[model samples]
Target: MNHTQQLVTTNPNLTHQNQVQTYNTLTFSEAWEFFFQGKISKDKLYSEVRAGKIPHLRLGTKILFRSATLETWFQQQELNSIR
Candidate 1:
């Protein structure tokens, strides 16, 4: 197997990051791994979602987040931190 294939096998999250744009929304796990790059814990993410502190949608038992929404949110976070 080549390097790309090796990476895919070793880190499934890389595959999700590559394919994130193709979807309109992302599952909870995919959103954190792709956007936060695992900088934050899953519990933090879940807490944000539960508290409505993050941009998200609820489909029955599943939670979904939009990449565009998160991109803007990150920018806002940066701006807030500068103040």
Candidate 2:
């Protein structure tokens, strides 16, 4: 089996593998860094997140986003732009 299959079959009780963990949410700085390779100004990143142009999750007053969701959003954007 490949690495991914092996990881899935591993015992769930073992934290070393087979355990998938996700961040509750990413801060603006954290999320921006993932998409952008270089330095990004805080003001611009915050503006984009606030404008609803970016995908995000809001829990009460807190803001968070799943990494996988962000990736899916990017893929959709690419497909839409191509058509």
Candidate 3:
């Protein structure tokens, strides 16, 4: 299995169907457009990635994030703000 597949299996937030949806990971632009929905600015996303506040993977010079991971992170952020 590949790294992405491993993430799908390990992430509890992903249903079997969602696992298929996320078989391919997301790039910064895709994640920003699809997952974040402009609630977070592009610069802030990059800053969080640099600070390791967001879940991500580094492949040489590239940064990748799984959709399931982003969903979970967003949910956690929501919960945190409520507390």
Write down the lDDT of every candidate, Cα atoms only.
0.79, 0.61, 0.79
lDDT of 3 by residue, 1-83 (tens): 78875886578887545653664588787677667767888999999999999999999988898877877887899999999
Name the weakest run of 10 consecutive residues (lDDT summed) in model 2: 15-24
lDDT value, residue 18 of candidate 1: 63
| Cα-based TM-score, every candidate | 0.73, 0.56, 0.67
Clashes of 2: 0
Top TM-score model: 1
For 1-83, candidate 2 gives per-residue lDDT tens digits of 66644653454554421122233345555566545423667677667779997788788877777766777787899999999
- Where does model 2 exceed 4 Å of error? 1-24
For candidate 1, the C-alpha RMSD (Å) to the true structure equals: 5.1
Which regions in candidate 3 have their CA more than 4 angstroms from the true location?
Answer: 1-23
Model 2, position 52, has a per-residue lDDT of 91
Alpha carbon deviation, residue 54, candidate 1 (Å): 0.6
User: With candidate 1 superimposed using the best TM-score fit, by how many Å does residue 44's alpha carbon deviate from the native?
Assistant: 1.0
Tens-digit lDDT track for model 1 on 1-83? 66644654476565554655544677898788778879999999999889998989999999999978987898998999999
How many residue-pair clashes does candidate 1 contain? 0
- Residue 41, model 3: lDDT of 89
